[model samples]
Target: MLSIRNLHASVDGTPILRGIDLEVKAGEVHAIMGPNGSGKSTFANVLAGREQCRVTQGEVHFQGHDLLAMSPEDRARAGVFLAFQYPVEIPGVSNIYFLKAALNAIRKYHGLEELDAMDFISRVKSKVEMVKMDEALIYRAVNEGFSGGEKKRNEILQMMVLEPALAILDETDSGLDIDALKTVADGVNQLRSDDRAFIVVTHYQRLLNYILPDHVHVLSNGRIVKSGGPELALELEERGYVWLNELTAGAA
Candidate 1:
């Protein structure tokens, strides 16, 4: 569903992603593991078309169209969803209103009629039940004063509501306890399907236990250095990233 080749990006004139090549097909989940400063988040931002991260060279095709050419809003409308590591709070906007507007916007982009209030509420409530989210939270301001777990669940709720084709979760496991982690992972797992894909970027392997990625990739120094199957995550857990760096150095 997504193809990236020799993708290079920079922020504030400082290079981060040197060259990234990845292909995500439908019905697959890929886990990107890396140490700090390895440009994992940068890669996700670039894919989402965040303006601060400029792509210097490369091409990204989403469903056969030029993905990098689209604006951030357009990308979101085109089914690219990024769940931020730290979800921001929009103090005054209730979550229900914000998500309804976003869902309607995407629907409108796809030439579908907007859901009226009653239908929209019914649809969102169903998803909330699926994710086991508290209905009360929907009436509150977006992410405002929510706990870390609540915020993460809120992100998944957004994903469930939008039903994006490609979901890039940037450290969604961060700051989550085991139960919270499982809850978030369960939400993601429930969304998996033959027509959707996931790119899970995380530092620890614990989250992989729940999400069960089909592929595991080690990213270092802005490039993906190794790719393997699910066992790769367990290997990384037993032997840290230093081992991968050493192996890369020896190979070089």
Candidate 2:
């Protein structure tokens, strides 16, 4: 569903992603694990078309379209979703209103009719239940007073409702307790289908235990040092990124 080749990105002319080449096929969940300053979040931001992180080199194609050439809105309309590690608070906008506007925008982009209020509410209520979110919270302003877990769950709720083709979750598991983590993971698991893909970026392997990625990649110095199956995550948890450092050094 997504193809990234020799992707290089920079912020203020300082490089973050040097050469990231990844192919995310439909229905595949790829976990990107790395230590601090390894460019995990930068890579996610780049994919999401954040303005500060400029693409210095390479190509990204989503569903055979030039993803880098598209604006952030175009990317989202094309079915690309990025769940930020820190979901921001929009004080004035009610959660339900924000969601409806976003969903309608994407639908409008694809020549589909917008969901009426009743239909949208019904659809959102089901997804809110799937994420185990409090129904009352949806009527309040978006993330204005939500707890850490609630904010994270809110991101998943957005993902579930949008039903994006490729979801880039940037440390969605960060700062979540085990219970909250399981709820979020369950929401993602429920959304998994034959044509959906996920790029899960995380610092530790604990999240992977629940989400169970099909592939695990280790990032060091902004490059993928090694990749393996799910077992690699366990190995990283046990051995840490020290071994991966050697692997990257060897490649250098």
Candidate 3:
């Protein structure tokens, strides 16, 4: 669903992603693994069009369209969702209000009618149940006073509500407990289908145990140095990134 070629990016005059290439086809789940300073987060931020990360080279095509050419909101409306590593607390904005606005905005972009209050409530309830979250949190302010699990679950809630064609989850399992991780993974797992794809950027293989990506990639020094199946994760767990860096250095 997303194709990236020779993708190079920089922020604050320092390159973060260099000569990166990744392709995720529909119905596939791809995981990006890397240690600190590996540019994994930079890849996700660039994909989301965070203005600061200028694309010095390469292109990101979403389902064959120039993804970089679109504005952030347009990209989102066109079916790209990024579940942030740290969800911001939007004070004074009710979660229900925020989601309703987002849903209506996306609906209008697709030439679909906005859901009425009753329909919106009913629809959101079903998605809430999918994440096994409580409805009371919806009426509260977005991310305000929410627990770590609640914030993560809320991110999944947005994914379910938007039903994006390609979802980029950045370090989603970072702060969750085992139970919360399972719930989040189950919610993401349920979203898998023949028409959608996922790019899971994470640091651990534990999340992979539940999500089971079709492919796994290891990012380092702004490049994807290794690509393999799920077993690559086991390799990383056993040998660490030192060996991977040796391979890339030898290649260079």
Q: Which lDDT values do the candidates have, in the order given?
A: 0.92, 0.94, 0.92
Highest-lDDT candidate:
2
Q: Write the per-residue lDDT of candidate 3 for residues 1-252, one digit (tens) a residue.
A: 888999999999998988998889999999999998989888998998889989999988997779999888988898999998989999999999999999898999999999999999998999999898899999999999899889999999999999999999999999899988998899889999999999999998889999999999999888888899999998998888888878779656
Ranking by TM-score: 2, 3, 1
User: Candidate 1's C-alpha lDDT?
Assistant: 0.92
Residue pairs whose backbone atoms clash in candidate 1: none
Residue 48 in candidate 3, Cα distance off native in Å: 1.0
Tens-digit lDDT track of model 2 for 19-69:
999999999999999998999999999989999999999999999989999
Off by over 4 Å in 1: 250-252
- The residue pairs found clashing in candidate 3 are none
Clashes of 2: 0
Alpha carbon lDDT at 130, candidate 2: 86
Question: Deviation in angstroms for 1 in model 2?
Answer: 1.2
In model 2, which residue pairs have backbone atoms overlapping below 3 Å?
none
Residue 8 local lDDT, model 3: 94
